[model samples]
Target: MTTPSARVVLKPKRARPLFAGHPWVFAQSIARVEGSPEPGDEVEVVSHEGATVGRGLFNPSSAIRARLYRWDGGPLDDAFWKARLETAVQLRRDVLGLDARNSAYRLVFSEGDGLSGLTVDRYGSCLVALFSSLALHRRRDAILDALRELTGAEGIIARPDRAVAKEEGLDVGDVRIVGTIPEDLTVFENGLSYKVDVLQGQKTGFYCDQRENREAVARYCLGKRVLDLFCFTGGFALNAAKAGAASVRAVDSSAPALATARENARINEVANVEFEQGDVPKILERLKAAGERFDVVICDPPKYAGHARDLAPALGAYARLNHAAVDVLSPGGILATCSCSGLVDRATFRDVLANVAEHSRRPVQILEQRGQGPDHPVSAPCPETDYLKCLIARVG
Candidate 1:
């Protein structure tokens, strides 16, 4: 058996053995490039000793230097894609127990499912795939064909993420790879119905990642005053109200989202909930000035750490949000704060809340630490699969 020579050399600081096969290779890690590898070129990433480390897509212009497609020398061809797609499909079929009632779930979760830089979420028979990397975006047609063959899904929608594309030096757009894609999608989460705008809404039109945590919040909302900050479409707030909360206040900066929240509340015919459209932090300040407090506080903020450099500032944002939330929580009230930042791990998330408690001089007891639901399964090899971190703490 012959050996493949090193095509690209990773900086001593860059080649970290992928730590259980993470697919990302940062630009700073590349020491030198032996040949001309284009943005979507498949190159052999190797150590200084000419050992074949892995096969990944090379992009010199992007912050992410490369995204490993496979490590075991599998060619990135139709057969390889079909096999991977079938495996991803089989996982949902067998592991998730997919049936008529719960036909919607995550089909492929990027690096978690061995498909780097690609995210596919299934809504019933319709599949929505998000491409955040240039390499994956360039290979959309082949991926779509593989998806169709593997799942026979009624529709396959391609949603190229603009934020990610910008970083990857690619253009962003939406297209229907298979059948017709629905403009509005309704899926049940924890026995609640939610409308997803797959064409225009945020991150595949629904926060499917929070399905488990929403149910977790429902368990503790019995006859309590619940306040949901950054309540997008009022998923947490409505769940609380449905769980017999005395009152629910849902606050968001987007008026349209607030309107949708009201529609959702009305759709469920829940009357004990109120929606506020304004800056959440400002609203929290006003509530504090008015001497208002909540029995259960839910703060689920968007990703403050889109990149590695944003980690510190994002942690500060989380801390400030938690401090404000804990300050307005009633004595012995429950505080459930969460962050979806990929760069922020569970330990950092816990430390962020701890810092908030210290700053506010509050004694906190952790009730539970929550992450993504089973539908969004985390691969044992990929730690980034477990991105969401929720801390259910009680502050006295």
Candidate 2:
């Protein structure tokens, strides 16, 4: 093992999180740097007592000053990356049975796979890699090489999260293609096929994190009228239709997404689903005013809160969105509501649901609570990895 050129020393007694296996070393915890290290450089992290804690990527510009990748002192090389990627893929295949029903699944879930800020999703033969940190972005070549060698994927693409890049003080360009990226890529989830525009799709072309939740929501849709809010590409709507929904109305503000949803519905030969393009909140109010009611309503909105400061407003927005969804639900209807905000804990989300039920004048019975699919595993020490929350309740 080679000695790291840079070293980060933590403040007095501030290495508790690192010792506890939490990967992030916040700017506040860092006391000083012993060597000159640029952003995206590997650095040794040590406690105030001068005991080595771990080796991590240093980013002085980010609030997360350092993100530990290895607790044991070792060099990060081709072999290391290959082992990490292989281990992540093996877990998905063995534990999640990812290849059995779905061609699209999260192969690596950032910190969950011991690789912070690097997410790789497989869309059939294509692999979409998202680098959220400057450190990972800088090592894209090595990572992509390992991915190609391990997965034997036909095409690999890089879609750096613009928000994350901006936060990390990195100026990243447009999406870069590494191999022969097919113009139209289709992936299967729960035995349902949907076309993926991997080159220009949302979050690696599809939201594979909600794969199991979508399937689970289908169980209650049999012979029921369903409403899928923010139904991007019709994952839940199609699943519900496949489960024998009487009628499924999928609503989203994005015309392109709705078009894709319609295409997916046609491809699946599911005629019960109707795609609508409009503001979801306004459309919900319109549906309520028109006396339209659904037996099963799903509200899976995007992340409302990204940081601590946005928590208050996000709670309010979630409450309003859920209230609107509940207002259009028939008595004894099922509501599958979700929040993908990491800042909002399960308790806070449940509280928001309760407040929505109260405001909507509907009493709710909790039926089931769900998180992201098993493929998107969460690390015990990193709470950020546990983001998605879905609550299924019966309202009357």
Candidate 3:
């Protein structure tokens, strides 16, 4: 291994997590820096006993002081990046067969793909890259080059997350265009086609992570009344409709999303879906007051808690949402609920569901527990990668 230009020594007993293969090294664990290193520069991490732990990108400005990419202290050069990008793309192509059925899929899943703070999603001929760390943003050019060479994509766009960029103190430009990208492109998933607005759409145009979950939920919707809450772009609702649901009412707070969902219904020739725009909680209350009940209800809200500090309130919000969902569910009805908050673990989410069922006076039996599809693989060392949690239960 080549010697790094700078070094960080961990305080006594602070190197245990690093030895255990945890990628992050907090600022508190760093005792000292041997040489001056600019933010995003590669640095060697050393234990207090003088043994090298690993090499990683260093940024003193952030709470996460270092993000180790390799434990063997390999050189982080152009070749290394190219090889990693190639391996990631090949895995999607060979293992997942992403292009066989769909043109949209996750190409790199940050820590899951061994590239922390970086995510790349492919939509048709376009590739959208999101950089959540200063180090990855600084090395975007090399990464983009590798992606272009490996995928032969028509265009590559940078979609830096605003909140994360602010937290990391990175000044990333907005919606950088690398090549030609269409304003509207259609992609196929699970035998369904939907139009995607890559530039303005949420999170790389669509929620490809929910691909498998939507298909799974469709099985229970056949000939049943379905209610899809927070139904952005009608992924679940449309799938339920395609599965021969007697009726499907999809609700969302965004008018634009509802408009897109309507268009999706038209394109797929699914006429059983009704799109409604309003606050989900208020709509649920109104539906309950009107004695509206569904055989299958899907409650998939956005992340309620982004950090650990907000877990308490987030749990309350989740419980309320599930309670409302359960209250509107008919006897022997199925409820497919989801939480995307990384701070809320699966066990805690299950507990929240149990509490909701208890408070609503509805007994429920667990049907299935699901998560993000295979393309968004989770790294065992990084629990944050395992964020999406979907629980399917039958309420009596």
Which of the two, 1 or 2, has more TM-score?
2
Poorest lDDT segment (10 consecutive residues) of candidate 2: 169-178
The Cα local distance difference test for each model comes to: 0.81, 0.89, 0.89
Q: What lDDT does model 1 reach? A: 0.81
| Candidate order by decreasing TM-score | 2, 3, 1
- Clashes in candidate 1: how many? 0
lDDT of candidate 2 over 1-396, digit per residue (tens): 697999999999899878778899999898999999999998999999999999999898999999998888997666887898899989988887778767999999999999988999998888999888888888888899888888889989986876577889766675667888888788888878999887666777799999989999999999999999999999999999999999999999988888899999989889988889999988988998999999999999998998879999999999898888888889999999999999999999999888977777789988998999888888898887899999999998
lDDT tens per residue, model 1, 352-374: 87787788888888999989877
lDDT of 1 at 289: 95
* Better lDDT candidate (1, 3): 3
**Which residue pairs show backbone clashes in model 2?**
none
lDDT of 2: 0.89
Cα-based TM-score, every candidate: 0.94, 0.97, 0.97
In model 3, which residue pairs have backbone atoms overlapping below 3 Å? none
Where is model 1 more than 4 Å wrong at Cα?
1-6, 13-16, 100-103, 174-177
